[model samples]
Target: MIEVPSRVSVRDLAKVFQDGEARVEAFAQITLEARPGEFLCLVGPSGCGKTTLLRCLAGIETPSAGAIEHRLEPGAPGAEQAMVFQQHGLFPWLTVEANLHFVLRESPVPRQEHDAIVQRLLERVGLARFRRFYPYQLSGGMNQRVALVRAFCVQPQVLLMDEPFVFLDYQNRIVLQDLLLELWQEQRQTILFVTHNINEAIALGDRVLVMPGTAGPFAREISCPFGRPRDVVQLRTNPDYQRIVVEVTQLLRQEQEHSLREGRIG
Candidate 1:
């Protein structure tokens, strides 16, 4: 198989925040590449700047230093990137279908084409029956599914997710993960996901990037060589999957210890 170049590249990325009279360094010299059609997860302790990194990639926030270059397809209008947050950023006043249609309408597509796209996405996310239902009528997981479909409908080249499944219950999270994988396979969009959950990251990511702490330049990168169309049930019994999870868990533990040591010193 021939190797393709990275779709997105970040070199020497750094970010700083002003806290009172002092300058607080969040991360420095962070370098990473997101290859085409790869699911990359950024995992670390809370406040480890994972969300900030995701924001930078989404163009929601600018990096204090370094460069991020998105190599878009020829003739494409800018680089299409979308972000899904932990909160379901849905409009309460709009119905499920209406919420999706609202986003689609913003695009340059004709009204007829936009309607078709919104209908298909609603059905795809298993919200066809809830199309007329408002956000308050849907459960937390269902609302999140709407959010995911809303983002996917735009056909973004890159999807930036920050703990999108964090609010769901265990069973809901599992179901949503499977649905997300299905959508990802169907769309083949490059994804950069941030999560504190190790198992979730291991299950979803083709490569996991682990950041050490809030002020981290990511410390480690682990590749998941397991074949996909990955099944949650089968993964529990797969030795390779188990081994990688163990390795990642160990790495996280080490980071925790390092964080504690730093805390004591400070």
Candidate 2:
């Protein structure tokens, strides 16, 4: 597969929503840069505007203020970006294989190669046998995996993920995380992932950015010391991993406390 390189630059970003007669600030004065093929994770408590910022970056939502610039290499595919939601967002009527085909149908992949692409991705994730199964027939974890590869099959230049594993049980979440990492390592799409899980952030991110719940820029930034081709399961045993976790935990706690004191969170 050919690589489509892209860079994302967000400057002084701010978002506000209307609630009856009042305006609520989801995030503000946020500035950041995502280099090509970089895995950047946004971790923060609820209402931190993590998802809001992601939507803005995806061009799904219009920011009240600020600018986002996307530089796509010439000849990049039209569908240069894709998003994975917290919910599976699978079609209840479509079978697993059919669901994948739905995405490929709109992608730049040629018609003759669609079947091959679908088969290869399904086999890589061990879902080849479940091709005929409907979404309801699969477990929550399997559905999430389907959502993931569906995005990957599109061969997007930028992938935006909003806590795709948040609803799964511990074991399933870890399993999907490993699968995600495997695909990401191979494809290396510029990704903006949102998660409240600190461990998951440290496990997957090349750099972790912490947001302060209200309209504010990232409160902290931590670069991962662990090397890539990471073993998410074994990361817990590494002393450096533990130390970074502690540091991030403290940063989050401070933000949580500030939000509480300001009555932003109950």
Q: Pick by lDDT: which candidate is best?
A: 2
lDDT score for residue 236 of model 1? 75
Clashing pairs in 1: 48-214
Which ten contiguous residues of candidate 1 have the minimum total lDDT?
A: 257-266
**Over 4 Å off in model 1, which ranges?**
1-3, 76-79, 108-110, 214-216, 264-266
Where is the poorest 10-residue window by lDDT in model 2? 71-80
The lDDT for every candidate, in the order shown, is 0.84, 0.89
lDDT of 2 by residue, 10-52 (tens): 9999999998998778889999988888999999877778888
Query: How far off is model 1, as Cα RMSD?
Result: 2.3
- For model 2, the superposed segments whose C-alpha errors exceed 4 Å read 1-6
Clashes, model 1? 1
